[model samples]
Target: MSGASNSGAALGSLLRQIIVWVVFAAVVVVLPHLFTSGSSISMMSQMGVFILFALSYNMLLGEAGMLSFGHAVYFGIGGFFTLHAIRAVNDGVFSWPLELMPLVGGAGGLLFGIIFGSVSTRRAGVTFAMITLGIGSLVESSANMFTDFFGGESGISANRVTEVTLLPFSYGPQIQVYYLIGAWTVFAALLMYLLTRTPLGRISNAVRDNPERAQFVGYNTTMARFVQFALSGFFAGIAGGLFAIMFEIMTASNVGLIQSGSVLLMTFIGGVGVFFGPIIGAVLITYMQTALSGFSEGWILYFGLLFVFMVMYAPMGIAGVIVAHFAPWRAGQLHRLIPVYALAVVPAMLALAGLVSVIEMGYHLSLAYDPSQPIDLFYMQVNVTRLLPWVVAVVVLAVGVALLKWVSGRIRERWNDINKTTERPEAAR
Candidate 1:
C-alpha cells in the first residue's frame, strides 16, 4: 500500500508538471493570435531564442558557478554554421528539414565547447574567464580575417524557406517561424530542466557550491566543469541557429563582445540562482530591446540604469524578488507588507521620473538629430537647452533621493518585524 501510494503521488506530481507546461505552450502558440502584429511576432520569436540562450548561460552561472565572458562564441559559431547548412541544403547538397537545422547549430557549439572547455576548464574563477575572453576575441577577429567563411563585415545571409517541408510551412511568414521557435524553445527548456535532475547536474551543483569539497569527495572538478560547459554551449548554439533562421543572416557581431555582455546582463538581471530566472531575464530584456528602441536613442542608457538598480536593490533579479514574497504570502502575512510597499512606491516613481528626465535631456542636447527638439516627459514639454528645465530635474532628483532613503528605512524595519514575527513560531518549535 505504501509503495502504491508513493507511485500514485509521483504520478500526480508528474501530471501537474505536464499540465503547467501544456498551458505555457498553449499561451505561447496563441500569443500571435492576440497580438496579431508582424513586429510583435518577430519580437516574441527573438524572445524565444534569447530564452534558450539565457537558460544555457544559467547552467554556467547558476548551476556551476562559472562566470563566462565569452559564452557568445558558441552561440555565434553555431549560428554561422547553421547559415552555411541552410545554403548547402538549398543548393541540393542534401535534403533536410528546417526543423532539424538547430541540431547542426548544437553540433557546432559542442565541437567548440570540446575545444575551448578543454583549455579553459583547467582553471577556475577569473583565470577561466580571462581564457574564455581571449578565445572569444580570437574567434571574433578570425570571423573578419577569414572572410571566405564569415563573409566579411556584411555577414552571411540565407533563405530559410529553401528547405522542403510536409506541413506547408514555407517558414517565410513570421508567425510560422515563431511557432517553430516556440516549439523548439519549450522542448529545449524541458531538456534543460530534466538535466537539472540528473546525477551530473547534482554534482555540478556540488562543484559550484564547494569545488574543494567536491574534489575531496573524489569528483574531478575540472571534468565536471567541462561537461557542464559543453552542455551549455550546445544549447547556446541551438539559440544561435534560431537567430540565424529568424534573421536569415549571420555576422561577426553575432559572436562578438557585445552579445557576450548582453547574455550576461540577461542572466544576472533575471535572477541567476534559479532555474527559470534566465527565462524571466530573457523575456524582460527582449521586450525592452524591441519596445524601447523605437522611442529613444538612449534606450541602452535606460536599460543599463535599470539593470544597475536591479543589481543593487533586488540582487536576486526580478524572479527572486517575486519568489522572496512567497513565504509571507503562503503564511498569510503578506498583507503586512502592503502599506510599506505602498509607501515606497511614491519615492520610487519620483526617482524614476527625475532620472528619466535627466537622461532624456542629456541625450537631446548631446546626440539628438536636432538638438533644438524639445523633450516630452509625463505630458510636459521641456527645453533641454534651457536652465529652468535643468534646475527642475536636479531638484526633483535630490528630493526623490531624500524621500527614498527615508521610506526605505521604514520599509526595511517593517520587513524585519514581519519576518521575525513569522519565524518566531518555527524557532520555538
Candidate 2:
C-alpha cells in the first residue's frame, strides 16, 4: 500500500510540473501576438537573451560548482562572431538564413571554451576563478586596444533587415523578432535542462561535491571540469548571439567583467540549487534593470546592496524562499498560499515603481545636466521644479515600503505555520 501511494504521488508531481511548464510555454508563445506593441516585443526579446545567459552561467555554478569570473569572454567572442556572421550574410559572402546567425556565436564559444578549458580545468575552486578573471580582463583590454577588430568604444552594428529570414516575417518587425526569440529561449532552456540528466551532468555534480572522492571512484576530475566548462561556454555563446541579433550591435560591454558579474548575480539570486531558479532571477533582474536604471543614478548602488542582502539572508535565492514555504509543493499545498502571495503583489509593485522613479530622476540629473536642469519627480519628464516633489516621493516610498514589508511578514508567518503543521506527521513518523 505504501509503495502504491508513493508511485501515485510521484506521478501526480510529474503531471503538475508538466502542466505548469506547458502553461508557461503557451503563454510565451501567445504573448507576442497579444501585445503586438513594438516596445513590449523588444523587451521580451531582451528577456530571452538574459534567460539564456543566466542559464548558461548556472551550468557552471549550479551543476559543476565552478565559479567563473571570465564567462563573459566566451559570450563576448560569440557576439563578435555573430556580428561578423551578420555582416557576411548581408554582404552575400555567406548564404545562411537570419534565423541561423546564433550558430555562429555557439561555434565561437565552443572553440574558445575548448582552448580555455584545457588550461583552466587543471585547477579548481579559487584558483580556477582567478584564472578566468585574468583571462577575461586580458580579453577585454585586448578588445579596447585592438580598435581595428572591436571598433573601439563605438562598438559594431549590423543591419537585421536582410534577405535571409526563414519565415515570411521580416526581422524589422518587433513581434516577429519576439516570436523568434521566444522559440529559441524555450529550445535552449530545454536543451540545458536535458543536459543535467546526462552522464556528464552526473559526473559534474560528483566533481562539484568532492573532487577527491570522484578521483577515488576512477573519474578524471580534470576531464569532467573541462567538458562542463566547454559546454557552459557554448550556451553562453548562444546567449551572446541572441543579444547581438536582438540589439543588432556588439560592444566591449558585452564581454567585460561587468557583464560576467551580472550573469553571476542573476544565477545566484535565482537559486543555484534549483534548475528553474536562474530563469526566475534572469527575468526579475532584467526587468528591474530596464525599469530602474532609467530613473536613478544610484541604481547600481541599490542593486549592489540588494545583492549583498540576498547573499547574506537568502543564500538559496528568491525561488528557494518560495519553495521553503510549500516544502513539497508537489503535494499541492502551494495552491493554498496563492491568495496571500497575490495580495502582496500590488503594494510591492507600487512601492518599487515609486522607488525606481526617484532613482531615475536622480540619475538623469547627474548624467545629463547639473543643478540647472529642473528635476521632475512625478511625471518623470524634465520640469523646472526644485526638490519639493523629490522629498515627498522619498517619504511616500519609505512609508509604502514599510507597509509592504509588514504585510509580507504576516504572509510569511502564516505560510510557515501551515507548512509546519503539514510536516509534523512526517517528522514524527
Candidate 3:
C-alpha cells in the first residue's frame, strides 16, 4: 500500500509538471497574437533571449554559487561563431537548417567553456570572479586584434533567411523569428530545470554550499563547478546564437562588460534564489530598457535606482516577495496583509512621482537645457528655470516618504501576526 501510494503521488506530480509546461508554452504562443506589432514581436524575441541568458547565469550564481562577471564571453563567442556559420550557409559552403544553428553556437560555447572553466574553476569565490573578468577582458581586446574574424568595429553580419529551414516558411518574418526564439527558450528552460534534478546538479549545489565537505565526500568540487560553468556557457551561447539570428549582427559590445553586467543585473534583480526569478527579472528589465529609454534620457538613472532599491529593501526580489506570501495564503491568513499592502502602495506611487519630477528636471537642466523650452512633467509643462515646481516636488516627495515610513511599521506588525498564526499550526503538529 505504501509503495502504491508513493507511485501514485509521483504520477500526480509528473502530471502537474506537464500541465505547467503546457500552460507556459500556451502563454508564449498566445502573447504574439495579443500584441500584434513588429516592434512588440521584436521586443518579445529579445526577452526570450535574455530569459535564457539570465536563467543560465542563475545556474552558476544561484545553483552552483559561482558569480561570473564575464559570462558574456561565451555569449559573444557563440554569437560570432553562429554568425560565421550562417555566413557559411549563405555562401553555399554548407547546407544546414537555420533552425539548428543555435546548436552550433552551443557547441562553440561548450568548447570555450571547457577551455576556460578548467582554469577559472581552480579557485572559487572572488578569485574565480576576477579570473572570469580577466578572461572576458582578454577576449574583448582580442576582438579588435582579430579583425578578420571579429570584423573589427563593424562586427559580423549574416542573413538568417537562407532558405534553409525544416518548415516550408522562410524565417524572414519577425513573427517567425519570435516563434523560433520561443521554441528554443522553452527547450533550454526545460533542460536547465532537468539539470537541477540530476547528479551533477546536486553535486554542484553541494559544492556551492560547502566545498570542503563536498571534497570530503569523495566529490571533486572543482570538477563539479567546471561542469556547471560549461553547461552555463552552453546555454548562454544558445542565447547568443539566437541573438545573432534575430539581429543578423554580432559586435564587440555583445561580449563586453556592459552585456555581462546587463545579464548579471537581470539575474540578480529576478532573485537568484528561485527558479523563475530570472524570468520575471528578464521580462521586466527588458520592457524597461525597450520602453523607458524612449521616454527619457535618464532611464539608466531610473534603472540604477531600481536595482539599488531591490538590493536594499527587497533583496529576495519581486518573485521572492511573491513567494513569501504562499505560506500565509495556504493558511488563509494572507488577507490580513492585503489592506496593509494597498495602504503602502499609495504613498509609494506618490513618492515615485515626485522622484520622477526631480529626475526629469535635473536631466532637462544638464542634457538639453533651453530657457525658452519647457520640460513635460506628469503631463504638464513645467519650467525648470522656475523655483516653485521644484519646491512643490520636494514637498510631495518628503510627505510621501514620511507616510511610507509610518505605514511600513504597520506592515511589519501585520506580517508578524500572520507568520505567528501560520507557524502555530505547524508547531502544534
| Candidate with maximal TM-score | 3
**TM-scores, one per candidate:** 0.96, 0.82, 0.98
- Give Cα-based local distance difference scores for all models: 0.91, 0.84, 0.92
TM-score, structure 2 vs. true: 0.82
lDDT of 3 by residue, 71-168 (tens): 99999888998999999998999988999999988988899999999999999999999999999899898999999889999999998999788988
Q: State the local distance difference test value for candidate 1.
A: 0.91
Candidate 3 is scored at a TM of 0.98
Q: Which order, best to worst by lDDT?
A: 3, 1, 2
Please give the ranking of all candidate structures by TM-score, highest first, separated by commas.
Answer: 3, 1, 2
1 against 3, candidate with superior lDDT: 3
lDDT string for model 1 (140-237, tens) is: 99998999778999999999997576577899989999999999899999999999999999999999999999999899999999999999999999
Candidate 3 yields a Cα-based lDDT of: 0.92
lDDT of 2 by residue, 1-429 (tens): 999999999999889977877886898998877867677777778888888888998989999999999999888888888888898888999788878778889899989999998998899999999999998898888887988667789888898778987888778877777777778788888889889989999999999999999999999999999999998899889888888888888899888999999999999999898888899889888887877677556768777877997998799998888777556476567777777778778777767766765766666656765655765555555442457657766776787788788877878787787778787878999
Clashing pairs for model 3 are none
> What residue runs in model 2 are displaced by over 4 Å at the alpha carbon?
1-17, 328-420
Tell me the TM-score of model 1. 0.96
